[model samples]
Target: MIGLGELVNSEGEFGVDDYRACLAAKHANLERAIQEEWERPAPDQISLTALKRRRLKVKDEIVRLRTGKAIGRRLAAPA
Candidate 1:
């Protein structure tokens, strides 16, 4: 897990934008991994699910950092 504090510096050398870009690279890598797994002759469902979850986490982190807010889930209306 990438900790926000680890990436940041006391001198402010790493700004939010830089951190976001780093996360962007990670996001792209995860996307490629997911696609590659999907393209296999027999994709591993477990592996795919894990990769997807990790990718989503990275995406959510990126959004939170960019917007200064956590992404909220929209609950379905009562039937």
Candidate 2:
């Protein structure tokens, strides 16, 4: 199964940056929704919980992509 962040271009590297941007936008939207829910006179706990969970999952995906896409490692032989 191809994951959203795992899709690469024909050149062997796709727009990780672009994907990150999209995720960032979604995260922002989710955050706004959460805030709006919180500010309501009677917030729905169930709805709030679901929104928070989705936000958290999105955040985690962002972090995962960040670590995988933004890191550089030097492979060396141990002496």
Q: Top model by lDDT, which number?
A: 1
Q: Over the stretch 1-79, how does candidate 2's per-residue lDDT look in tens digits?
A: 2344454554445465656666788888889999999999999999999999998998998898878855453322223
Q: How many pairs of residues collide in model 1?
A: 0
State candidate 2's TM-score: 0.68
Regions of model 2 farther than 4 Å from truth: 1-14, 69-79
What lDDT score goes with residue 62 in model 1?
Answer: 93
Candidate 1, position 57, lDDT: 97
Taking all chains together, each candidate's TM-score versus the true structure is 0.70, 0.68
Per-residue lDDT of candidate 1, residues 1-79 (tens digit): 3545555566535566657777888889899999999999999999999999999998999988868663344322223
Q: Which candidate should be chosen as best, given TM-score against the real structure?
A: 1
Give the residue spans of candidate 1 off by over 4 A: 1-13, 70-79
